[model samples]
Target: MMQPDTLTVFYDGGCPLCRREIATYRALKPQGVRWINVADARPAAGGGTGSACPLDRAALLARFHVQRPDGRMVSGARAFILLWHRVPRFRWLGRVAGTPPLPALLEGGYRLFLRLRPWIVRRAVRDKRAAPPG
Candidate 1:
């Protein structure tokens, strides 16, 4: 069960970029935040005992999602904004980006990124495979 103050983040762990970003956030140890990896068969926090994700697996995996403390589920750039506000290092960026026009512009950019993500991920994988062992 999630507390009313808990913010839940739904992320796709299968994507390398997403995984790396999520790992960075986890390292930050934000307060009152729960990270759920939608790519897992049974996703949850603390060894699969957290509350179930609000959306179905497909919907959760489609884009970035953040369930605010108030229980509002936000996606895309708006979702990123909500997440940024929770992290001390990103709060300023969130405030600036959440401003009018910026949010819209950021959303457009996010949409484009989504469209190119598959190719980007494939290229990243290919590059990793071709890199010689350190």
Candidate 2:
């Protein structure tokens, strides 16, 4: 469980794109945001590297997620909103995006991104393991 002031973010560390984005957020060093990479084996679900509300590994890897201080788990575009809400520069954007019907529109776009995420990850990483075996 998170402290009243903290928000826990769950991400896939193995993903190059995810790593880069998380690094960017880490650079900002926003207060009360705890980032966890779910790529670790046997991730804890009660806080720290593990999430307060754990999801299946596959599900965690498939989308972005965040657990609020109250232990509610949110994901995809909504998760991004919670994150942006913490960052000073992006706070307005988060609030605006979170407004009525905007989340729904963003979710539609997020679902489309999910469909192409494999391709995007492959292109971003360009690692041998991510490449097609021949």
Candidate 3:
């Protein structure tokens, strides 16, 4: 509800699942928003708040992050909702995500997602390990 300039989304690019979801988001959405794949979310000088991409990759991979036009940063479900709202079709999903119960639901879902993420990461790592040296 604050300013509407640029939006920065912090996601773990190493995770194929996360990348897939981001790809879907990018596919449907236009150029209105800027997606930032950060390795970390910790505040940095002109980082996060700034409209930069591929910054602080280490922090972003740790968790989900979103920086609003108000220069405020939110993580987890809140961040997801912010990006969802930007999509024309998913506006309602974003609104629902903001609701008290929905945020809770989203948190629960995120927990489950986390449970599965490690398996995904391990498998991905294993695949890379198995690949012949090139």
The candidate that achieves the highest TM-score relative to the unseen native structure = 1
Candidate-wise lDDT, in order: 0.84, 0.83, 0.73
lDDT of 2 by residue, 23-133 (tens): 888888878998778888475554334434557777788899988888888999999999999987788989999998999999999999889888998776677667798
Residue 26, candidate 1: C-alpha displacement in angstroms: 1.4
Find the 10 residues in a row with the least total lDDT in model 1. 43-52
Give lDDT tens digits, candidate 3, residues 5-124.
Answer: 877677776677788888988988744577765533345675542434334545566678887776677777888898989876788999988999888789788878777889977898
Clashes found in each candidate (C-alpha, N, C closer than 3 A)? 0, 0, 10
Q: Give the alpha carbon lDDT tens digit for every residue of 1-134 in model 1.
A: 65678888989999999999988888877777888887875745543324554677777788999988877789999998888888868889889999999999999999999999999999999999999999
Pairs in clash, predicted candidate 2: none
Per-model root-mean-square deviation over C-alphas: 3.8, 4.8, 5.3
Which candidate order results from sorting by lDDT in descending order? 1, 2, 3
Task: Kindly report which residue stretches of model 2 are placed more than 4 angstroms away from their true locations once superposed.
Answer: 41-51, 127-134
Each prediction's TM-score against the native?
0.88, 0.82, 0.70
Off by over 4 Å in 1: 41-52
